[model samples]
Target: MTAASRPKSVYPLGAKAVRILVADDHLVYRIGIRNLLGSEPGFDVVGEAADGLQAVELYRKLRPDVLLLDLRMPHKNGVEVVRAIRQEHQTARILVVTSYQTEEEVFQVLQAGAQGYVVKDVGRETLIEAIRAVNAGTRWVPPAIQKQFSDRVLRQELTAREIEVLRLLTRGLTNREIANVYGISANTVKNHLNNLMAKLDVADRTEAVSFCLARGIVKPEEI
Candidate 1:
């Protein structure tokens, strides 16, 4: 069959519109998302919250078909809200919508029972697809971010300790200096550096540091 004749995976038109609860600290972001989905044929923007506490309250009251939640918010974080909503409503369809793409942050939300995870920078069509996919009892992760995590999982290059070492390395610290600061042997520091290089796909310390900085593994001020 031709690509144009391929079956679509999303719900059919005129189906039960997916009710969405949007939660974000920024008013502009919330408004933007509301406007975007509001125009879509099968989406109903039911409720909105400015923080995690409000999100939980709205989730209870609105019981929307899907919850688009931010990670960092005042009063409570998205992870806490996800855990809270999941406690009583095991079938809660929550798609973590956040700017954070770090491994630790993603792991925390996933462990808390998020059905779908997507980053904010995803394109409009992909964002809508994510909402529909999550509502349809499937998970959605942006391709780029998925590749990032998949590579990390496959390489198994950086332990938590190695990440720390790379962070310090980005600060332009020498191995001996890092050893002195962390109270570890110089050889241990060197070992951590080697592991970080492998994980970062870099050949040397400078390349590893550059890779980490480029990928947001290190803050600008840390350099």
Candidate 2:
């Protein structure tokens, strides 16, 4: 049998299974996730959706315990689907599972009502943990992302220039481009970035952006 024909296992255990719906445009990836999740002891793969629209439809129809959403898809994207679901079901428990790990994207999903966010590159163990945490009325943002959120809430020591630099960073602009945009020297941009990182208590640009979004310093739609 070919890889495509491999069997997909479903786990049936005594624990109250967390019903799940997987949404992604890629057929193989969706199926792979179903197989992986199905093999877990307390997860039920209730449905699969190939796009955001379909995901929303399935969410309404199945009301699964968790909605595993992919950020990019044909005919609406994850953000749209999340909004649609939340509008109809205020108590929705959505988890964004996507390939893009940028702070801007992560922040947008959470603001849209996602209980947790996990990057596609995350290990299977971390992925499972995130799902469990979200299902248990808890949250699971990366530590770096969490720090950004916390700093933003307290309006910590970030200076005006640092905020500008951080906002530009969320836009995914290069250091040189940011400098040009602000009429500053490249070295000056680097210095601002260093200070921003220090003030945010983060070690890198990604974390800073995530922090900014988590704290509402930068709106996701603006990115």
Candidate 3:
């Protein structure tokens, strides 16, 4: 069913139902999630949002007990949405359900105050468990995701300037062009590149860009 035609609230058949707001860019995914959650005993799928902005807006209106958010949405990405919602409602329970599994994506959303992160391909039971866990004020990160996140935490982090340089590198900018963009010398740009490459554990600029792209640290559209 279309989001517009779907029931605004599914009455709970059990005591103390968990109200949920589903947000994703894809209509099919939203419908699928709504159906899946609606089948559970204590779930009340209260609303649906088709994009990040709508997600934020709906959260304000519905105030669901749990929000199932997708990481990549128009108007605002998951990180931005989490930060926006948490800024207004510190106790908001958000669970990121997305296909993106890159360490950077997971870390960014969690840092922005998401209570849980689960890949889209997780089993139905796991997804339901995560929602329930987050609703009960617990942080949920699957074992594999937690391990990758831990590994990323142990590695050296890239400085803001270094990350900026990396983005420019992905755009195929030359050292001179990048330096000019930042009002720095070519030598300074080279220094940033070298530092970023070291932190990323890549051999050269090309490898650094490739690594960032592969790891979802720098998205192609952002370039």
What is candidate 3's TM-score against the reference? 0.64
The TM-score of predicted model 2 comes to 0.64
Task: Give stretches of model 1 more than 4 Å off.
Answer: 1-13, 147-223
Question: Please, what are the lDDT tens digits per residue for candidate 1 over residues 1-223?
Answer: 3334534345586689999999999999999899778766688999999999999999999999999999999999988999999998999999998888787677668778898888888877778899989999997876666656565453454577887787787777888999998999999998887767766778999887777766666657755
lDDT string for model 2 (65-168, tens) is: 88888999999888889889999998888888888866666666777888888778887668888888888878888887675555444454677777778778
Q: Which ten contiguous residues of candidate 3 have the minimum total lDDT?
A: 3-12
Listed in order, each prediction's TM-score against the native is: 0.63, 0.64, 0.64
Rank the candidate models, highest lDDT first: 3, 1, 2
- Put the candidates in TM-score order, highest first: 3, 2, 1
Error of 1 at 102 (Å): 1.4
Per-model CA lDDT versus the true structure: 0.83, 0.82, 0.88
Better of 1 and 2 by lDDT: 1
Candidate 3, backbone clash total = 0
Best by lDDT: 3
- Pairs that collide in candidate 2 are 148-211
